[model samples]
Target: MTAGVETQASAKVSAPSASRVRVEAAAPRPNMGWIVPTLYILFLMLPIYWLVNMSFKTNTEITGTFSLWPQNPTLRNYIVIFTDPAWYSGYINSIIYVVMNTVISVAVALPAAYAFSRYRFLGDKHLFFWLLTNRMAPPAVFALPFFQLYSAFGLIDTHIAVALAHCLFNVPLAVWILEGFMSGVPKEIDETAYIDGYSFPRFFARIFVPLIASGIGVAAFFCFMFSWVELLIARTLTTTAAKPIAATMTRTVSASGMDWGVLAAAGVLTIIPGALVIYFVRNYIAKGFALGRV
Candidate 1:
């Protein structure tokens, strides 16, 4: 009887364990989880690939041939851009204004963001809303005003003009982003710095800035991209000297029809700056998105 009872207990324990093992073994593992991401990447890459392919083909081949790759690849389009002063200068002008805008926007936003995150005052909410409202208005609405304003200041056809104009939108966005990141940091850090006989500017530069470095990166990245790609305001604000690569591309449409190959090459070149910016700040952007800290 004793032996039989022991056998029964062992059987009972082993039965459930064996069943659990079987159930686990029968359970379906994740089936090709990489498929969706792979498909997504391919979808995103297809247009870029087509654009690159088109860049290598002549206008005739581009319009006539339909292929996954260029049938008769040529360097003429890229050569045209590299050799032409107007074409190359447009790229330089774009880089200048974009850099200027990013600097000004981030510099102004840092102090303003610190204020918003650390203090409370009358109309603070209203003030913040007002700043964001500037961002809310369409660029078209501001285009004429910016043109007139820059005209008044003799700032037209200048890189600084475009940079300052872009600040109208970018400053508010930078503030909003930086404020969120600043708020995530503890007030105790500020207080402790004060206790240690650190001056306001010193503490801000040395400690607070590093703490919110990712936010700055994210803000600067956005500012650079917006200033780089924005055509309407940049076009409205400049006619020739400061005209961006985007504006120059529009001129490719001539009496002989569009220079599709050259245009494709220009478009591909335009993507480079934004791609580089993303590569550098990708970590910051990822962290910001994940934690809502930036």
Candidate 2:
């Protein structure tokens, strides 16, 4: 009876200690990993914070002092932009071209990416390298050529001109991103579908497309960002009707003077669409990189 009691006592002691050790092992380490990212985020956000602060201040307050926060904030700057046809129209023009560019880049790149990933065609490597080379070429070199080309087609000063121009860079990038993701997927899945009597188009549409949906989202987001932010090409292509917000920003500096408040407000506004785009695709970005084609 005494030996049995001693054995029960030992069991209770060992169980608690094992449980404590397990709890300790499962506990997370102190998060020093976040320090760099936190600092980077702060660095990125500071300029945006300043711009937003400046947007709320009046012209006098902005010019008078360098303060982190406005003493007297005003909504007049935002009102000015929203009410004015010139200011609002610039946003509309920017949206039209950006959307058009994103759609064209994604659509064209998807097929090209599929071809590159799935097939071993003639001059495939040379063709891909050539396509990527377009992105490497200086935008300045193409400015004149783009103007001449669009002018010949009577598309100068139009959204289509800017969209087409953006595609010169974005399409290649989209194709590269998508091809990487597509290549990661197993060929066995494709073979299985073919053996199961599924046609190529139907199988691709139903099975392969869903697998790389994350990559598509990521590529689309990148296309939108590049097209939206591009200043030189958009400016060179569009004269008035489709003039981007980046070009509209130049209007703030004229012969008479510089409108700093309006400029700050416009700058703050430019960030909104990009921010929204990033937010929507943020989840896909992580997956895109993780599951990218081998």
Candidate 3:
């Protein structure tokens, strides 16, 4: 009787096991998860790939043919960009102002953000909202006003003019970003530093800054991008001496028609600075995003 009972229990267990196996076998398999993302990436890459292809080909070939790849590869487009004063100087001017804007924005924001995060002041919330309002306003709204103001100061057509104008937007954004990161840090840190007889500047530079380095990187990255790609303000404030590559690309017309090859080459070159910035700050930006600190 005990043996028969044991056999019955074994049979019950085996029955479910067999049923589960059969169900799994009959279930439809899922399709590949990567297909959609892969196709989307390829779609986005098409324009950039086409741009690079055109950059390598001569204007005649570019206009006459619609090849996926360059038929007659030539470096003449790149050569002109590198050698020509107008072409290369735009790159230089852009880099100068971008660097300046990044530095100034981050520098100003660090102190302001620290203040906002650490201490309460009169109209602090109102002040913070006002700062955001500046960022929200379009660049075009400020462009003409900036142009006129800079003109009065004889600052138009100068790299500093663009850099400083960019600060009007960048500083507020930097402050907002840095404030969020700073607030995440414990107030005990500041007290601890003060108890150890560390001054504000030294403590901020040595202890506090390192802790929020990711936030600074995120802020600086944004500042660099805005100053780099901005056209209207940069275009309106400068006629020639400080024209960005963005403005230069628009003026690519020649007597022979549009300098399509050189324009394409310039477009390719224009992507490099932003790419470099992204590569450097990608990790920090990722952290900022993950933590919702930005």
Best candidate according to lDDT: 1
Model 1 lDDT, residue 145, Cα:
89
Give the per-residue lDDT of model 3 (tens digit) for 76-162.
999999999999999999999999999999998999999999999999999999999989989978888998899999998999999
Which sequence of candidate numbers ranks them by lDDT, best first?
Answer: 1, 3, 2
Question: Backbone clashes in each candidate structure, one number apiece?
Answer: 0, 4, 0
**lDDT (CA) per prediction:** 0.90, 0.88, 0.90
Sort by TM-score, top down from the best: 1, 2, 3
Per-residue alpha-carbon lDDT of candidate 2 for residues 9-75, written as tens digits (9 for 90 to 100): 9877754544335455454767688799999999999989999999999888888888999889898
In candidate 3, list every pair of residues with a backbone clash. none
What's model 1's overall lDDT? Answer: 0.90
Q: How far out, in Å, is residue 132 in model 1?
A: 0.9
- Whole-model lDDT for model 2 versus the true structure? 0.88
Better of 1 and 2 by lDDT: 1
